[model samples]
Target: MAWDYKVIDGSEEKTDLGFRDEPALNHKRTRILDACKRRDIDDLQALAISRGGFLTDAIRCQAWPILLGVHVDQRGEQDGISDSWTTLKKHRDEGQVKLDVNRSFVYYPNDDTQAQLDEKKSQLSDLITEVLRRQPYLCYFQGYHDICQVFLLVLPPATRAAAVARLSALRIRDFMLPSLNPSVAQLRLIPDILRAADPTLYAHVSRTEPFFALPDTLTMFAHNVRRYSDIARLFDALLAREQAFTLYVFAQIVLRRRDELFLQDEPDMLHFTLSKLPQDLDLDALIVNTAALFERFPPESLRSWRSVSSSSTLKTVRDVSACAAQTLEDGHRFFEKHHRELIWAQRRDKVLRTAWANRALILAVVVGAGAVYFRKAPIWSNLAWSVPDHYF
Candidate 1:
């Protein structure tokens, strides 16, 4: 039920800017790629944890899919390349997806030209839509786009959908479920992680709403961390380790800000402070602390904190593999029984929704709503909303 923790020792060397030097980083990159070539998962994972992460974008493109357990051939197969775009046409979440896409320009750096930002946003929308179409059973949460944006930037377009699909089905599986119940279950692990890492800080935060950890969990730190580059580095390390390791990283973030959080006694103030991450956070140190925390209190010890039989816990690659297989089987059964009716209904609903959205857009434009139209559209109603039972 728990993972075997491998402790990484020795101090890491870094430059004045807090990054490892080029030669040392290149060495880590080489080892990671070599491990991938040999399909040596243990070595890749060890390097990821010990070295902190992959060194460059080039290295992540090659290493990330391997870490996510995605196969080269499986990309097109899982995405169903033949009809993916067609299926996307019928996605009930399309309206909400566009709203989220419009807000995703923040993923780009402020200095970039509007043209570059627009291109990236368009690519992001396409990639997310493709992934959703392939895995129609997975619900699209509001912050899910933040996580997908990372892949769109790092991985090649050809591999992005498959990589994101595997990631959603594996490490982030619980969050993509039909309801928020599983996500809440995952967030509950934060306190348990904090209790193991730093008991005093754990007690202080336990008194507040644990929902402060929600954004970090849902967005994979993409929402919290301002810099895209920093988020990529953090994700490089996260993707390399077991899925549950993110709990430790988040706990480390809390402990890093314990001085500020400790001063706030009110739940509202504590939540507010925790929600907005500091811009100047030293990511390298946080990653080091996260790895150290994992070594100190592995998943085995945390499982004892589970209060209910249905509670979700940290899953290993093997466990995830089994779960993915079962999920695929269930999808096949569901398709066999209801594919015809579901496809027809989805198509009909898509037509109605698209017409409604078009008419609303036209009305807003005629009324001179301008930017307000995009921001105040009824798509916001989808916030905190789930699909109807029939759709599920």
Candidate 2:
């Protein structure tokens, strides 16, 4: 059941360096199709990361579900379940989903009617709602609809929920937390990558934090990249690699603009420049260079890697080869584990904050579930001050 997907009208702009000839384009398409036929995920990933992305949205319709481990049989699984989901408890984030869905399709489908777009928005709303219903614990972020809209455009309706659920769990789960701290933690990786790739440029841009990458990276560039085909092609690589590769791609973008970045001596100017992507983006070069950069400076070698906790989905899940075998069940399992960890982190932070805020009160007494007991020991005094100021 496909809607009026009026976006991809075959007027895809050609990249100067990527797939310049029909034979090359055909070769890439053939490889992707062949990989899909054989269910050779590794080859599919290689093709995705290679020259041109699953060349067209047509090809993406065939290849994307496979990339996310959404099997052919899994299509339409969400169809009959919606009624039941409606009866069950609704997710807390549904209101925000409606708000975001209402504002979607802002950039593409230039010729569709308000009626057609409203239908698309309705479908988008249902798709997001269905996923959230299935996994009520998954927090919703403002830009999540941007990412979901891409899948809705590329995949058939039956498979849309399955594809997006895996994507939400495996790929962008970090952003779906109640707090944006995990997402900010991902932004922290960008500078580490930049520093490793080019010390001079990193030093030049070091005065500013990595919040510049927050918008683009959070939405997987779906929010910032206005062109439909360009973003769809970008997703080809993004879906194929580990989540950390997204950070590397942005880092490569930063590295590519070294001269432009160096010109901005002031941190504010450099940050403002960096926050917006270039008008003339050569996605092919960026993807290729990003791949090379990741190869050279993999995540484990970076400083941020050490800081990511053991339970982070950032660390535990999202390995390309590992994800190739993962199913929706695996995704849910990983998500539940990660969600628990995130909740624990939040609670720990809250307790630390409260303890620090009322240090004098906590210092005066030892309150236990069993009883409230006064403490007058050196150990209590030491413990009271031990709560670090950084946690505050």
Candidate 3:
């Protein structure tokens, strides 16, 4: 087969081709996620060691954080796992579990009147106490802003307060970094599922960049999409009713689609099917999805709600978001309304001050000149009028 290319060594060789076994890969991924949820560090560690050869996504999300603190990566270590864990402990140990976890900000007003910022602090303190009394274990749990919000929405005022207190520390920024593990996982899998559904997109990536293909779309479970009850119930009948819960989407999507995408050298049909799913999901939708995952909303629910990071007390994060938005918009509006006037006033002020200073200087010079002119002129006139000793 290789007669003319003797000088060139055939380093690359094609492997044997066969139909893929997808079920087995899915089972393997499920085991990884289950262990992660349980905080079973040892098993996760073992899996990482076993799959060291494979480009690992699970290990980075789960077991990698365990070593996040001790060494390996220092820059992210403090804020990544350690800081989050510390805040979690602080809330729990200081009895902040029952204290409102809140941030501080002020609301905007229609009229420019007295607006105080310190008013909400005490109220939030009380709310935190009430929520924590109900779900104390929610203290160490830091992920999304929705969980605490769901508690606030679902519970009694007293319970809402306590839950708000504990969940208040959850930051939006927390959803951005090493904390962004879930989002990263979901985003990575978006292409996976897309590729499964649409292969040409997958083929372009694989042929050009092997590392860039998506195998599934399950990380969306955490995104908290509201499914029709009928649909969810039907899915439940096939799997553990709770298994398809959006919170468990990472497990379902990635685990399920791994073999379909991974083992299949042929990226046709399946990859093309996966590629067409919508990518631009809104944050509000994300909030709604996660909220539905842990807390089952009434099927006939009228409202789509969200959870937020608390301030120093239990006030609505929506309120805070609104307030902040209002403040920014108001400030912009105020600047827009008054900018020309402000500039005119400033110019007028500079003109007035300058004129006043110049006037004082001119007045002093005039008065001095008048007195000297009158006295000196009179003397000169008299001297000129008197010709020697005679009066002229």
Candidate 4:
């Protein structure tokens, strides 16, 4: 069950066994297992971000639930747990989920037969449908299946549904909204982070919109990173930290390629290069650097912090996630409140845009009529000018 890592120089040599010290793999595994046994979440979180992430998926099966604030021992025991989520109710996004699920397993389990892949896709669809139906408020985005498939591949069947539900409601709820605005707001943090961490590179790439990072941050890099092992390692750190940590990881990615990014003269070139991550990314180093950047410039210190309101799930989820008393109920309440506010804001914006358009049209018509009258009635125009001159 050891994870494989290729050498950095395009060589076929498998250099990393998912541990810094080869002998310490077993020692680290023992400590992780002990933490699981003791249910020591703090220690586990520290270990997850340390040198090699939870080592193997076998360990992740136990550690991930703990990170998401779910107890692996008490699987399916959450309040309102039921079989009806999969069978009785139908979510609005189930159709989209089926379409995406059919396209799942495109990158991982390289040796799976067609039948095995089909089975996993069916399970992936069921898992997503279960969450969306139960939390009818959550809207399914296209790449959601990418994130869900990681859970499906790693966690057991009984544990998968609750874990995905908690993750959706808490971790990635911003992306599942009726619109992508909340998620875009989160991407805005990347520029602020780069501005603080590497001002030169930030200035170099300032012309580009943060949309280049949408694929990475929106799906938690599940859609961008092709390897299952690489993404699982990434999720280890993402789950262990605050929700905003994904932006920092992406900022680190940009900073890592400062030299290459600097060479690109046009903003479009910079954006195109950054839209996708490097295939040979050293995730362990990237994770470590992200932690340092986060510590150096925490979310509150960022210039973009003022842009995200206190009521946003971006802020609310981060606030409750670290609290001992936080529950899935808190996530549900926050989502409902945010959803209402977003709908209201959209309506207000629509009204304002319509009003402005009408005002512009009316102003244009008045100007047009005045021109026509002046052209047709030169005497009136002369009188108007004479009167203004006499008054002045």
CA displacement after TM-score superposition, residue 214 of candidate 4 (Å): 0.5
lDDT of 1 by residue, 1-392 (tens): 11111111111222233334656655666788898788676676666656446655666777787776666654444333455475454566867888998888584555557777788788888887877777777678888888988788778777787788777765676676555655676677788878877788888888776798888878888877876667877897787776677877888888888899889998788888877877887777777778788888876678544541122325433243343333433433433333344455568989989978799777877778656665576775574255576765
Model 2, span 1-392: residue lDDT tens = 11112234333344332545667766777888998888777887788877667777777877887777676554446322445556668888898899999999999766677888898999999899988998777889988999999888887777898788888876777787677777888888888887888888888888998899988899999988887777887999998888888888899888889888888988889889999988577887789888999999998889888877554556755466677566656656766776677788789999999999999877666555214332456677688789899888
Distance from true location, Cα of 347 in model 1, Å: 31
Assess the local accuracy of residue 270 in candidate 4 as a C-alpha lDDT between 0 and 100: 81
Candidate 4, which ten residues in sequence have the lowest lDDT sum? Answer: 6-15
> Whole-model Cα lDDT per candidate?
0.68, 0.79, 0.32, 0.80
Which stretches of model 1 miss by more than 4 angstroms? 1-22, 73-84, 87-89, 303-313, 316-392
Please report how far candidate 1 places residue 71 from its true position, in Å.
1.9
- How well is each residue in 1-392 modelled by candidate 4, as lDDT tens digits? 34454322122323265555555777888999999888777788788788778877778888888777675445546445655664667888778888888888888767677887888888888888888888898889988998999899878787788888888888788887787888888888999999988788889988899999998888889997887778888899988787888899989989989899989999888889989789999888889889899899999998888888565656765642363245778778878888888899899999999988799788899999998988779797677777855577
Candidates ranked by lDDT? 4, 2, 1, 3
Model 3: how far is 314 from its true place, Å? 28
For model 4, which pairs clash?
none
Clashing pairs in 2: 76-158
In model 2, where is the ten-residue run with the lowest total lDDT? 1-10
